[model samples]
Every structure is written in C-alpha cells, then in structure tokens.
Target: MAEPTDTAKTEQVLTEGNEAGVPRRDEERLKKWFIGSIDQGTTSTRFLIFDGTGTPIASHQLEFKQIYLHSGWIDHDPVEIVQTVETCIEEATKEFTKQGHSTSDIKAIGLSTQRETTVLWDIETGDLLHNAIAWPDTRTHAIVHELKNRKGADKLQDICGLPLSTYPSSVKLIWMLRNVDKVKKAYDEGRLAFGTIDTWLLFNLNGKERKLHVTDVTNASRTMFVNLHKLEYDSTVLDFFQLDPQKLKLPKIVPCSDPNAFGSMASGPLKGVKITGCLGDQSAALVGQLGFSPGMAKNTYGTGCFLLYNVGEKPVISHHGLLATVGYHFGGQRKPVYALEGSIAVAGSAVQFLRNNFKFIEASPDINDLAATVKDNGGCVFVTAFSGLFAPYWIDDAKGTIFGITQFTERGHIARATMEATCFQTKAILDAMEKDSGHKLAQLAVDGGMSNSDLCMQTQADLIGIPVDRPVMRETTSLGAAIAAGFAVDIWKEFDELKEINKEDRTIFKPQMTTGQSNGMYKRWERAVEMSKGWVDDSDDIPPSS
Candidate 1:
C-alpha cells in the first residue's frame, strides 16, 4: 500500500477522533479548533474568540444605550441588543481571521448574558413588544410589595429560592403584562413570547427560520418562576402571579452546558457554528473562574457585584438572606451544582455615578488613581444605595448616602469611600455566604470591570482577611462561555484539563490590614448603611401600571 499523503493523514486524524468518540488534544488539532463566546452584559455586548487553551485571540465590545424613561427605571432596546451581538460577532471573527485563523476553525459558540432582564416579543414576527426591563429597575417595587402581602408570598423563597423583589424577571414580566397594552394583548391572544436576555438573544440569533426558545438553568433560576428543587417552572408560583403558562409562551429551560439546546447561528460571521453552551453572567463568571468544585467561590464586579459560593449537589436554602441558585448544570448525566449567592446591585455603577453624575472623575478608571491619592476616607462612608442595597441588607428603601462629609472632605476622600463601599458590601455578602454554606472562603477568585483596580482588590482582601485572586484575562465572563462551549464540542475532554489552561500568571491580593482595623471600618460601614435606610417614601409614588 502507498504511504498516505499529508492531506489524507490530516483527514484520518480528524475522522478517527470522531469515529472513536475521543477528544483530540494534539497541538495541530488544537490549533485548528477555536471556541466563541457572546458576553451580553448590562452595559455592553461582547464577542470573544478563544483558542483551546482559554486565551482570548480577538474580541469586540459595543456599549448599547441604557434608557431611563423615569426616575428609578431602566430599560434597553431588545432589537438593539440583538444587532449589537451580530455586529460584535462579525467584527471579532474578522479580526480572528485577520490574525491567520480560519473562521471555519470556530467550532462552537456559548452565551453569557445579563440575567433577569425581561424581554417580550411577538411569537410569530419576533418583534419586541416593549423595551427590555433592566434587572435594576425599581418600577416593580409596588407590584413586589403587593405580591409580598399576599398569602403564600412568604413561601416563595422556599420554592424559587428568591425573595419577592424588583430584581427578578417575574416581577418585571408582570409589570409588562399589566402596563404594556401590546404585551397584554399578545398574552391574551397566546402570541406573547417571554424570556430573559439569554433566551431573547438565542431566539433572535437562531432567527425566525428555526423555532428556538430556551434559557439555561442559571438564567431560569433568576426569574422567580422555577422551583429550585425541580429545576422547572412551578405551577403554584405561576398561579400566584396570575400567569397561565398556557397563555404566555415561556422559553424552555435547558442545561448550562448543552450540545444542542441553544441551536446554531443562522446569520452573521458565525453562521454555521453550533451554539453548545449558555449561562447567566454571574454563573458564567463562576465557570470562567473554574469554580467547579465545592467550597470554591468567585466574585464578579461588573455593573453589579455577584458572589457565588459553590455548595455541592444539594441546595442549601439561605437562612441568612442570601439566595440559593443553580451554579451551573452541564447536561447529560452530570448532576447540577448549587450556590449561595449575595448580590450587590451597585459596584461599577457607583464609579459611573461618580464620573457622570458627580463629575468627580473624567473616566471610570480615573477614580482609582484619584482614590489612591487619599490616605483614608477622611471619616466619609458612602452607602452606595443609589438603587437600594441588596443581599444581606435587603434595604430597598435606602437611597445613596454620603456620611461624615465636611469641609475637609474632597473628591479623593469620596472616591476612597466609594471604593470602600463596594468592599464593605462584598465583605457583608461573604459573611452571609459563610453562614449559609458553612464554608469559610479561604480566598476569592475575582473578575470583571472593577477587579482591574488593584487598590479596590487589595481593599477587598484586607476587608475579607483573605487573598483575592484576579486572573490576567479579566474577561472570565467570556472565557467561561468559551470554556463551556469548548467542553461540549470535546475540545476540552475533562475539567482536570482546564486547570492547565489560564494558570500562568495571576495577581494575588493578600490581606494587609489588621483584623481589628478591618472590623472597625466594617462596623462604621454598617452604621452608615443603617443611616441610609428608610429614605425612600414609596407611598406617594405611582404604581408601575399607572
């Protein structure tokens, strides 16, 4: 027999791996396989391309408009979000191809989206019925209050693992159903399609040509509709909300890492690529940080701060005001892992307030430099409750407060206080996680926009009295989706193999302040937070439907 040619050898290697159902880890094979991730965040939409080793090769990010129609309300155009995703994919893939990589090498795509942002659209035409209700929007406060007063409302936490709050998609969906005539009409006619950001993106990306509407377990967990134990929409909860599933077209809930649920991209640069994975942003951050094992925890500091502590298989319902949520579920025989989460609604957004609202800094990063100029907060403590405090505190009536401000205070002092506010909230959440999970975090894996600030991270370490690990990538949200996608396609055969990737150089911020000093500062922060409560008088405010 004649020796096989080079082309024949390559074909045999690729075909044999598929036929044998084994992962190909050869360097040559790895060089030809790439994974893509769409990180649809609150402030921006990003498309990232990564090689098998979890290194980002190319990325494109676009900041979409944040619509504030009224005070304490936030919305986003669903159509614009879809367009941004397509634009990012096209631009990023072009850069990837420009860097001597084949667009065909992009094997699969994963999605990490901002969770709980409600989107309603026409089932047939796919036209958005209303602006996507942002997770931070407080328009649903009255509805949340009314729901809380109902009989069986307190039991909601037992079933959904979430308290009645405007932060959830269910409340937002309810608001749309009551306020938007188009949404109500569609629901009455059985033509309304409801989903979180991930489902909306998946539906639009898969196009109207193929009927695809599904949300991952992590995203579904945030809607206050799914039962934590059953991992499906609860009938009792839906009935309590007066929502009949038969009337509204809700997305099907799927696994976080699935080979086929998400469907393929019908258009854009990644037209033929299979979408194999999907996660909410926080869960994606956890996956990106490789927090797969029990007792591992990660904190993502984006527009908001989310700390997820992995609690193994069985869910531990939080008695400490933390949330019990599905961390990630890689389908097919793998059991789902649970997490105790503490969510802080304002983190990087506080910095944005400083830049845009206060004009204390010209840019977001400049707050760090300015903050470094101050030796201390000069007795100032900012509660940062611009959108109400979340997590252990759960004080929705609180407004942003700046305490101990005197003639001696300057922008630097306030900046320092601003940074400290997030650290204090993180420390509060960490304390709650430990209480709920019974696992004291030895160290925290950190990622996202605010984690880039060395001062902020060091402060976090000091406050928590533990090490803070920040990966060099800082884009772990995207990396996490890429990791999930890669896993589904057999590019990454096992979780053990992931340990070898993205482990080169990481920045570790160790505790520097004494325990007593840290405790004292936190105590002062608590006092400031207490003082900020009850500032909002909701009685005079009109209802969302009005």
Candidate 2:
C-alpha cells in the first residue's frame, strides 16, 4: 500500500463517520470546546466565554448601581446583582453563537466573585433580608473594634487566616444580626442564610429550587468561619463571632474545581450547563496567571487591589499584617494551595473618583494621558484611604487626604500621584510578602482594569524594582474561572495542559528609574500616609438614611 497521507487519513475518518450514519457536522463539533465564566465584581458583573486555548471569544460587562447609603457604607441590591449576571450571560452567549459556534460546545461554567461581600436571605422565602454589604463597607467599623476586644480576638488569624477587620463577612453579618430587625428575626428563627457573593450567586444561578448553598474554599476563607487547616467551618471561630453553627445557615465549603459540587443552571442561556468551578476573584486571577508554584504572585487591580502570593500547599499565618488565605483547591485528591494576601481598598476607584468627583479627567484611561503630561508627581501625594487603608497599614481612621499639594501642583500632578498611590501600596505589599514568605519575588503578574495603562504598569515596575508582566488578554480573572471549569470537565486534564494558555504577547515592564529614586518616592508616600491618619474619629460614622 502506498501509505495513506495525513490528509487521506482525515478524509478516511470522515468517510467512515458518514457511512456509519453520523453527521459530518457533529463530528466536526466534537473538535470544538468552550467554557463560560461569570466574573461578578464589586462595581460590575461580567460573563466571558473562552475556547479551549484560554482565548476569550466573547464577553459582556455591565456596571451596576453602587449604593452609598452613607459615608463609608456601600450596598448592592442582591436582585440587581443576579439580574446583571443573567444579562451578561445572555449577551455574551449571543455573541458566542453569532461567531458560528454551538452553545452545546460550552462544556461547563465557572464562577469568580468579589470575596467577602456578604449577602443574607431568608432560607424559606429566598428573599434578601437586607442589601448586600460590600466587603469594603465600613458600617461595621464599630463592630470591628468590639470584635478586637472580645475574647479569643487575638487568636482569630491563627484559626481563620484573617484578622479582625471590617473586610471580612463575619463582622458584617454580626452587625446585621444585632442591628437589623428582620435579619435578627430570621436568625432567631433559623431562617437566615449567610453567604459571600459566591454562595448567593450560586444559590440563585442554580435556581431557587436546588438552593445550592455552597462556597469554594477561596471564598469560604474570607468569611472567617473556615478553619484554614481543615478547610471546613470552625465552630470555635464561629463562637468567637457569637454565631451559632446550628442556627446560621452557612454554605458548605467545597473545592475550587469540582465536577458536581456546583450544580447545573436551571434556566438561562446556559441552561443545564454544569457549574464545575468557583473561586474568589483574586484567587481566580492567580490561577489564570498560572501562579501555581510557591513564591509566584499575581496582583489584580479592580475597584480595589489585591496581591496574592502562593505559599504552597500549607497556609502560612502572617506575622506581618497581610492575610493568610487559600489560594485555590482543585478537587479529587489535590491539596489546597495557600496564599499570603495584601489588599488595597482603593485602586481603580481612585481614577473613578478623579473622573467623577474631581473632574480631573473625563475617563479612567484619560488619567494616564494626563499623568504622562507631568514628568513626575510634582511633590503631590494622594493617600487614597477613601474608607480606610487596608492590609499592612490597616488604618481605620484615615480619610482621603492629598498631601504636598502646592501652587505648582496641577491636576496632572495629582493624577500622577493617584497612579503612584496604588503602585506604592503594591511595593509595600510585595516587600511585606517577601518578609513573610522568606523568598524575594523577581517579577509580578499584573491584571485587572488598572493594569491596562502602560504608564501605570511602568510606574509599578519602577517603584517595585521588578518586572511587571501583563498578559495580552487582561481578563485573567475570567480566564481563571474558565480554566478551573475546564479542568473539572476534562477539557484540560492537568496543569501542564495550560502551559500554552495565555502565554503569547505578554508585555513586561522593566525598571526605568534608579533604586534611589524609587526609595525616595516610597519614603514620601509613607510620610503622606502618616500625615493622613486620625482624620476620622471613632464616632465619625454617618447615620444611615431613613
């Protein structure tokens, strides 16, 4: 036989399929695979569709209303958040199908949500008890102080891997149970369901019928109820918050990637598509960036900024102020990965502040052009402690304060300083992470809205004294979710299968300034931070609107 050529082999297979009464289109369809990711964020909701190669083929994003009921208070209508997710899925699916692909090609869906944004609902009625308390909301400021004074407060981080702070869902839930009449009533009656955004969305997305009240380890770690070691709810920690493990309807903790832990959609554009994976947004970013090895780190700049450094399979309790959190846990005998995290309360929101409040620029990206006009910050420093400084500083009384503003300072100066604020904080976090982990990072993987700006990334590289790597597709958060889902469904079987995903056209910003220059800028930032403290008194909370 003249050995069949490669083209002849393909033709023979197709001919055999046709002769076997199988449609050629169905055979061709087997070669195509897709995954969907729901990236529910603080300021917006997004649904992205990705091919097997981790390329985003279609996506849609929608910014929802940010309810500022009072100073330092932020709320989101739980109904609106879910609606936005459905709309994004519908729109993104339309786009996906428009590109000559079948919806059946979507093997599974994954969820990545803003962590610690607490949502409570009536377990029986499935009605929200109150507006969702966003993670950054400081309405629980008083509660945090009380929590810090409570017995076992000092041992909280050891148990749950989080400090006694306003950011965790536990504090917010405690505040509601004490203050909100309906919330307290529901709690007393055992009708209350407590969940971070993941649990809430999963509850709704899987349809109220299934009532899929579950959370991945990454999200559960932020609730301060999970024992970081066991990866399960800790009754001792629950008691520390005055929560009854029996009464409170806490979500079951599951792995980040699982075939059946998260149920299939009941109805929607992706009806019956299994939700095979879920992770907190920052964790998803790390997974998407392929930061699987210890000492590898990734930073996500959304409404806020979070830097997660993988510390291997075991959790490391930070002696520094950074948080200890689960990096990610893929199911099926895979051990949970741990991370040391440093959170900044304001990042892209500062640009929104300049655009809306200061009118310094018409849009976010415009600030980059404006900042470029100024060679440097012109001695201006903006301590964007809008609610309060988070992570290493944990300053509760600091308000947004601009220091070193002078007659020579312009909006461009302020813009440059605003950009530096995030970069400076990142440098602080990176330094602290190195100290805690005992390994110096040579580079940082950066993503999210703010990382799109070349100027900002270059500044980050200059300030941090390391290369900043930004992927060509900046939607690593969404991509991470898809990767998790893909893994669960066998679209990808192992970590090595992802080596080629999101690997092309990455821009690496290298250091452009002297070490002395970087140190000087950081020193100025530290001074500004110190000077901005104590701007808000303990009793400075604004009363909620009637």
Candidate 3:
C-alpha cells in the first residue's frame, strides 16, 4: 500500500478512533497507538503493524540475496540486511497510516531475528567488518571440530544442553576472529563490537548512539558464550575462543519486555516510538501461538524448522540433543518460562531449492499438488541435509541424500518424498522432545509458510500420531513480537488477558494413518538419514539436494 494523502490520512485515523463498536481508551491516543515489529529471518526481512489484539494490520516483506563464496561459506551483505530492514518498517507503517491509522499509534517496537547469524562491526565507525555471516553458514565447521578435539566436548551438552555443532554462534565468532582481517584489526584497536543481527539492528536503529546493544535470552543461548544457568557470558567459553571481553561491549542480556530491557525507535514511519521486546524468531512464534501453558508446543516451518515446548517457570536442560531456551520473559510474568527446542535446518526452503535449482516445480504449492498425485511415496525418501542435520543428530559435515529410488520413482514420488522429509524430521525432533521433557506433546500448534498446505498439516499430524492445529493467521512470529511490545506498553494489563484472544478459528488435523504405516514410513526415513551421515563437501558446489 502507498502513503495516503494528508487529508485522507487525517480523516481515516480520526474515523477509526470514532468507531462505536468497541470501547478503546483515549480514542485520540488509540488513533496514534500502533506496534512495530521487525522480523529478520534466514531468507527475508519483514515489518508488520498491529492493533492491540495481536493481529497484523499492515506488513511489508523483502527477500535478500544469500552469498555462498565457498561451498560452506554463507553470508549476507550486512548493509543490505540493515537497510532493507529499516525500509520495510517504514513501508509497512505507511500502509497502516494510509488505512485509518497513524504512525504515532506504534507505542513500542519489538524485534524477532533469525537466531545464530553473527555480525561484527566497528564501534567507532558503525560499519560492518564482514558480511552478516548467516545461521546456515558453514565456515565454522572446522572451528567446531577443533573445539570438540579439546578434552571437554562431552561436558558441553551438560552445560549448554547442546553438542559441538556449526549451528551455534560461538564457533562463528571464533572463525571471524581467526580469519577476518578487519575483525583482527578491530580487536587490536579496541574497536570491536560483536553481535547477532539483533545487536547490529539495535546499534543502527538507535542511530549508532549510546550503542544500546542487547539480546534477549533466546538469542544469547544460540551463542555458546552464555552460561545457560547464570545468563551471563561464560568466562571459560569466552576464554576458549580467546576473545577479549574488555575490548568488546557485551550487550546487556535482558528479558523480552518493559523499561530496563530496551531503547526507543529513533526514526521510521513510527518515529519516536519506544521500543521494548525481543526474541529469536521461533520463540516469538511460540508466544504468538499463545502456547503459554505447559504441554502446549508449536512448530514453525519456515526456511528451517523449529519446535518449542513450553516448560513453565524454570529451565529444563535436555538429555537429548534438543536445546534448552527461554520460552518468554515478559514484565507481566514475574517468573520466566523455558522450552525444549529442536531445529531442523531445512523445511520450506527445501521446496524452494527444488523450484529454483532443479526446476522440479515452478510454483511451491505445485509440489503439494504433485505430491498428492500418489497415495504414498514410491519407496523414495529425500533426506534434507542442506546445512546438515540439527537436533538429535548434530552432524556438521553431513549433506543431503535420497534413497530407495527405482524406475517407478517419478518426479511426483520425489516431490511427495520431499514433503515427507519435513514431517519425518519433525517426528524425530518431537520424539526427542518427549524423551527429554518426559511430557508428551498432545496437539502441536503450527504456523509459517508450509503450514498453509493442508496435505503437509495432515502429514505432520499423521507422522507424529497427534492432532496439528493451524491458526487463521499464518504470521505468528510477528504476532509474538507484537504480544511482547503490547505488554511493555501496557496495552494489556496482564498476561492472562492474552488468553481471551481467539484461536478457535483453527483447523485441527487428526492422525488417520495406521501406526504400522506411520512407524514403517518413519523407519525408511531413519535409513535415509543414516545414508546422509558423514557426507560433507569442502569445495564450492550446489547446496546439497533437498
């Protein structure tokens, strides 16, 4: 949507405030009260505007270029990620202002970013020392290998509830320190500032002023620096990487809401807005889904896959390879909740690979139609190891593989198998989640791009042998961030008020596939995953077949 003419905006903003259908405080203030959400994801950037009840009124989205200078090296132009993000925030709010709302309505801004993407910038100049090394970047593979080589590899799982894998930010930070010329210079000059996309945006968003750098607990855990128990950077972990603590400004790790944890939005269509909430994308999606109670869980199928199970009040370190992360930490809730997280590195992006690379399908949803052509996969199984397996199997070097192919295995069969890959991986992660939490996931609340496909939802429910719930609104990540900001700005009095927000407009898929078929299909998936093991590529090549 384009900007409204000045007169039109004046009339619309006023008209919306005058609606008699509801009783909103300070109709004049409500006219100016909007929430801004900046959602930075693996492949794209999006900005959304929300009214008080957790619905997106307007949004703008853009996809950025991913750089793969080497087979394992994935990067993003830091400048592009920064600039595009700001532009989207402006554009989305412009749309809202045009349609009976005003920029001033945005009382607070919340942030949700792709976890584990590392950035290093100069404090003095505020310039990126290197491209934003993305979460999928594999340049840290060797660093993880070296860390594990030291005698204490097994001890990390107990401390962090995670194994040595390239997915974590610790190895990524170390790789930059040892390899990047600019990072070394900054370190020596006492000008180094390290952060994920969150810190990068925070610095830039605050006009590079006061260096108001911080990360929510959810993002911090992805970096190996944070001691899960203390919520501070681990001295031993920092020493292991040989990073100078004094030289770099460690962002104050804070909860997701209210005054202490934040700074205000300096400029945009929503200029002068006080900024207050932050979460890594997946965690925000959980909050958006309103999975506040224990036993409630959500799985988002976006560029990658993430499952978060709400474990109330205290952290539950996983015995399995699953990660222990902060579920939500709002000012309204005195006690913080925890989650057992399982990440699979490929999901909707797997279909994008087929559509863009091999020319298997022109439109993504066509894969859904084509896959449904057959009742089941024709003994074909696609193992999506694009960035290697995550959770349960943290194989850094493993690449993609496909097995059980025969002459009967047509494109339709392969397409069906690809979709099944996501379902199968979710099942594996869910099994581990249940094992570690000792709490069975009853019905999974799901959102994101792939959840739009009915077939995929049924497949996910059937494979896991549980019902899958899909909400009317697909963009839960943004909604989650909005919830945090709302709490910070006092748009709602308490966390319990959020429960009244309707989710009854949902579709629930129940398991119909017999247990034998589900187990038998899953066993084939296991074998395919086994074949994908130890398949690493050191040279530049196409990302492994999804």
Please list the C-alpha lDDT of all candidates, in the order they appear.
0.88, 0.89, 0.81
Alpha carbon lDDT at 32, candidate 1: 63
Q: Could you estimate the TM-score for every candidate? A: 0.94, 0.93, 0.91
- Candidate RMSDs in Å, in order, are 3.5, 5.4, 5.7
Better of 1 and 3 by lDDT: 1
**Clash count list over all predictions:** 0, 0, 5
| Candidate whose TM-score is highest | 1
Instruction: Encode model 3's per-residue lDDT on 41-143: one tens digit a residue.
Output: 9889999987766667899999999887976678988788888888898888778878977665567788899988999988888877988788877777767
Model 1 whole-model lDDT (C-alpha atoms): 0.88
lDDT at position 328, candidate 2: 94
Off by more than 4 A, model 1: 1-29, 540-546
Q: What's the TM for model 3? A: 0.91
Write the candidate numbers in order of decreasing lDDT: 2, 1, 3
Residue runs of model 2 more than 4 Å from their true location after superposition:
1-31, 538-546
Off by over 4 Å in 3: 1-33, 537-546
Compared to the true structure, candidate 1 yields what TM-score? Answer: 0.94
| Model 2: per-residue Cα lDDT over 1-546, one tens digit each | 799753344334334457673313223332466899999999999999987677788999999999998789999988999999999999999999999989987889999999999999998889999999998898887788778888899998998898888889998999899889999999989999999999999999988977789999999999998899999999899888878866789998889999899998888878999999999999999999999899899999889999999999999999888999999999898899999999999999999999999888887889889999989988899999997999888988789999988899998999999989999999999889889988889999999989989999999999999999999988999989998987787666568657777788999999999999999999999999999888766566477699
lDDT of 1 by residue, 1-546 (tens): 999753454345444657674434455555566889999999899999988777788999999999998888999999999999999999999999899888877888999999999999899888889999999888887787789899899899999899888789999999989999999999999999999999999988998767688999999999999999999999999999999899899889989887788999998778878899999999999989999899999999999999999999888888888999999988878899999899999999999999989899898989889999989999999999877888988877788989999999999999999988989999999998888776789999998888989999999999999999988888899988988887677667567767756666999999999999999999999999889988767676668784
Clashes of 2: 0
